[model samples]
Target: MDIFADFTQRINVAVQTVLTHYEAGDVDLSRVTVEPPRDESHGDLATNAAMVLAKPLGAKPRDLATRIAAKLARDPDVATAEVAGPGFINLRLHPGYWLKHLAGLLAEGSDYGRGAPTGRKVNVEYVSANPTGPMHVGHTRGAVVGDAIANLMAFSGDEVTKEYYINDAGEQVSVLARSVFLRYREALGEDIGEIPAGLYPGDYLVPVGQQLAERYGAALRGMDEAEWLPIVRDAAIDGMMAMIRDDLTKLGVNQDVFFSERTLHADNGGRIAEAIEDLRARGFVYQGTLPPPKGQLPEDWEDREQTLLRSTEVGDDVDRPLVKSDGRYTYFAADVAYFRDKYERGFNEMVYVLGADHGGYVKRLEAVARAVSQGAAHLDVVLCQLVKLFRDGEPVTMSKRAGNFVTLSDVVDEVGRDAVRFMMLFRKSDAPLDFDFKKVTEQSKDNPVFYVQYAHARCQSVFRQAEGAGLALPDFRALDAGALDALTDEGELALIRKLAAFPRLVQSAARAKEPHRVPFFLYDLAQGFHAQYNRGRDLTHLRFVNPDEASISLARLALVKGVATVIASGLALVGVDAPDEMR
Candidate 1:
């Protein structure tokens, strides 16, 4: 049940009534906002309708607040409604009303917070890591973050497409081909020396080379660079992609699309030339000399004519180059085509989850979306900060036995997928996170994932305890129709109030495109459950299994079910498991 939404609507109705009373029909109710009070003791909710409507209606804030208060105080659902300092109206919902809200939660179960279709198609692109090797820990955060965002948007009724842009057409994949060739020679018993500076050094490619030998043997060894290069390059890209997909599967990130960069250069209706010509026809492309870049200029920097995009007209800091002196398309040129393709695919919004180091590219890509879609589409970039790994307060590095960087597989193997996924989103996306090996697995309140999971498990335990006592949960129709007057305790009201905030949390997090809020909200909900459970320890009547308070125990059991169901729903959004037991 969205208690906040209901109250917000009520407040909106009251504001509209006041506006009509004043004959100020032009006043917009959209400006009025309803929110939870900063301090719970003040009230369950607070509204800024009075302050928002005062100037528009030509009335003082206090005077409008007094009027709004009189209207809301008369609501049977509201136990008290008072005008607070200045113009805020604090509202305390009746205890019986909160109990009914708990019954609503019990009735909804898994379907709670799921939204109806909004008819908007959203594309969330993340983890566009180079297909050069296994994914390292750096890519893990983006993978989890992007996947969670897609999940959240999907749950919130948007048609979401999860995408991964494979960087297979670049010089990096060529290096990977050469590196895998080294391993190929090694597999054939040739003494290939140390991996050179520009080639990939990870041992993960050793398998690719071995596979190449099994497929082609020494036949391609006699061929020149041109002939064997493509063969080996294709093999390397496919092999590396396989390894990357395996790692992503370990973290439960299965993207709906893996867009290949090579396709943009080769097929799919356009290479760089076609897309550039299209932009030129639209007057976004021009041949001119760009001013020198800010800060230190490159050694090759010179005042020379080149093909450039007039991206600055939209929002970019400077007009970007589309073609180089050597007559090849720049990276930005390819991106214009990529974003244009996504726009044509019917996406209204494009979300790019990139590393913080790519901050400079954000404006250029945004300009590309605007230019390509003619201002009909929006592009949002989420820059994920770096993650530092630690084990027992000491920095964790590459595995000694594996002889590779600390890949995503290594972390997932050590900590399991749930901890990895949860801790990755435990902090804000732009904030640097320290993934502590020792702390995440500890069974203590300090570990948020553990704490939240335990709360879910505790809820399950309550159900089992009740079941063992021959108590069965009533059907939803009965639960929905039953009165919960026995649940009048302060703790019971607090728990119900927190449960009422679930739909609000989901809506806000989905709107902000911040999936981290789900985990954060789950932590608070878990803490509330624990607090309520701890309260029952000293007061036998407060316990869920109280023999002397059967009706109250049954009502609290419904609350327990609400906690478990909501926790599961939230963990599903974050791609983490909500365990029935801690172990």
Candidate 2:
């Protein structure tokens, strides 16, 4: 149950009662919120009912707060309600309420934080790396962020579709095809030395070259460039995409759809042309001339008139080109078609998980949504900042396998999947991250992944110890509230409060599109569990399993089990494993 939501309703009722008593009618109550107090010592919960309503009612803030507090003081669950500062009402809940909630949590088990259905179809497209080579560290953050957001949304009741847009129609993949051709010639014993400067120089293409040689051999060597380019291009894209898929699989990311950009360019750009025509029918497309870019000479500008989209009228910084003077559709036109395709597929929200460098694309993408959907759909772009890799405080830059950058596979292979996924989300997606190989693998509290996983393992360890001591837990399915009454310690109550906040946390994080909050909450919960465990060590009476006191032992064991279940549920949402034992 979402206690915050429950209290919000309770507090709103109190506000309505106060307003009616004062003959104040028809005031908007949406701004009133009940949340945890900023300072734990203040109270268990706090509300701003008076602060939001006093102005509308033309009453002093403190007077409204006193009335609201007095009304809330009558609640059986509220142990104390006091006005704080100018208008906030702080509440302390009775200990019995927490104990009963703990029992309910233990009953819910793995589904504790699962949300009700929202009925909104959300398409989260991320890691649309060019299909030219294996994924590098730059793409790793975007991949993890997207996957975690999708998982979070799915957990929080939205119907989420994970997708990848393959950049197969770009010039980079053409260079990749040519690079593979060079490797093919070399594999066939031709002295094709020194890869050209403009082509890819990575050694990963050697296998593709060998495969091409094994299939076509001398036949491709004699064919015209036009005849052989398509064959090699298709082969190279397939090879690279296979490698990319393997890398993603290793990192625990599996997309539900892999949309090919080449499809939009098929039949001589039919899809893009159709999208432009649709926009034209909506009066968003026009023939226009773009002014020369600032700080550039007029001679350096493409000053010719061209087919354009009136994107600025919608939301973009400026009107964007749709078709070039040469009659080819611009890249933005393809983006428009892609968005229309998603909108037609019934996605009410399209979330783009792009790299930080794609900041300029945000406004135009939003414009596309506004123009194409006519405000019927929403577009959100999350920009993930770059990850700087370090080893023992020193920068480690080069990767021999990827030729120029560290591949995502290399990072995963070095530190394992759990560490990579957890660390990628340890910080907000927009903030720069410094990932240290030595630090993440360290088995200490400073390492968040290790700390959280160890907390789960410790909970398991507690159960194992209980089993060895011949203390059979009471049937948790039939567990009673009386058993949980033994948990009256401040530390135990604090942990329960943290655990109770998960459902609300999931809803907020999912709505904000911030998957990093999951890891943050998990870390805090782990810290609380660890602290409570230490408390038990110093005080024998507070231990989880006491042979002499079966009642209290059963209660504490159930609490430990609840902690483990919540941690496991959270880790699974982020695609991280919570091990039963950590050695």
Candidate 3:
């Protein structure tokens, strides 16, 4: 249960009662909010009710605050509701109020932080790296962020699909095919030295070429370019895709769908043409000339009439061209078809995780979503910023390996997956991140994953000590009704308040589509638990293992178990593990 939410409702009831007592008027409850005080010394919570409602009622904020505080003080749940600066109200909830709900944590266990159902089907498309090469560090960030968002939404009861768009139809893969063909020739005893420019030079292609040589020795070489292109391309794509999927598996990211861009080409059922025709029938497509692009114009820029989609009608800055003057569909045409395909799959919400370089695609994709879904689905684009590798405050050399980039597998193999996943989400998706290889593995408070896991480990350590003290592992959920009331200390109450905020926090994070908030919350929670544990060192009575007082120790044990449950749940959401021991 969300104890804070219940308190907010109570505060609303008191405000309603105050309005009736003053014979004033009804105020919008939605405008009111109950949140933690900026300074813990002030009180447990603060509200802006009086300040928000005074303007509507044509009264001074201080006067409104005084009247509302009087009514709130009468509430059974509120121990004190003091009026602060500018009609701000500070509230101290009754200790008993939090005490009762502490049992909700033990009862719910890891299920404590789950959010209510959103009743929306969401499709999260991410890390759709081309099948031309392995995933890089940039792709890793997108992969982790996207996977976290999908897991969060799934936990919130949204039917979510994790998807990857294979860009095998592009020029990049054509180069890959050529590169693999070179390797295949080399495997067939040809002197293929010095890879040509504009072709992939990654050594990873050696194996793909070897496979081609073993499968059809000298057969592909005799065939014409067009005849052998598809065969060689398909083999290379399959091999690269297998490697990419293995890298993702190492990072614990799983995709429900791997959509292929090749399927939208004219030779592959002409989905792009069908999409363009559908748009033309809707009166949204036309032959039009786009003005020379702003700033530096392309050397080949010309005012030619071509097939264009009215992207501006939705929200894009300009209408987008669907086809080139050569009668070939542009990349945006394939994208439009892909968007329409996702919409037809019954998803009411779409999320695209793109790299920072692809920021401009946001508007065009949004425009496509609006056109295809007819505004029935909401599209959110998360642009992941770059991650620079560092080592102990010095820049770490991430020399570009195969395909002109450091593969994601290299980073995961270097630092464990936990550090990679947690550090990837340690900052907002759009913010720049410096991932330090040395610092991430250090067992220090600055290492957020370690700190958070250590808190859970401490909780387990307490249970182990309890077992040695003649107390068995008891069913904490079935503890006495008064189990939590034994936790009346100020530190205990503060921890309870934080635990009680889990459900609300999960819901807020899901609503904002931000999974970075999970790590922030976990780190803050770990600090709280660590501080509480350290306090026991100075105060013997506060210790979790007290032979003199079995009941108090057991009640505190339940709270400790609650902490572990929440840590595990939050870690699961972020695709990290919550270990029972730091060792």
Per-model root-mean-square deviation over C-alphas: 1.6, 1.4, 2.1
Instruction: Report lDDT (CA) for all predictions.
Output: 0.87, 0.92, 0.87
Which lDDT tens digits does candidate 1 get at residues 320-370? Answer: 888877677777788988887898899999899999999988899989888
Model 1: runs farther than 4 Å from truth?
267-269, 299-302, 400-404
Query: If scored against the real structure, what TM-score would every candidate get?
Result: 0.97, 0.98, 0.95
lDDT of 2 by residue, 1-583 (tens): 8999999999988888888777986989899898989998999999999999999899999999999999999999999999999999999999888888888888888888888899999999999999899999989999999999999999989999999999999778788889999999988999988888999989999999999999997889999989999999999999999999999999999999999999999999899999999999989999979987678554423578789999999878889888888787788899999999999999999999999999989999999999999999999999999999999999987898788999999999999999999999999999999999999999999999999999999999998999899998666756767888889898898888899999999889889999999999999999999999998899988888898898889889888987898899999988899999998
Give residue 41's lDDT in candidate 1 (0 to 100). 85
Error of 2 at 538 (Å): 1.2
Which pairs clash (backbone N, Cα, C closer than 3 Å) in model 2?
none
Q: In model 3, where do residues sit more than 4 Å from their true spots?
A: 21-28, 266-269, 299-301, 398-403
With a 3 Å backbone cut-off (N, CA, C), the pairs that clash in candidate 1 are none
Candidate 2 error regions (>4 Å): 296-301
- Error at 516, model 3, angstroms: 1.5
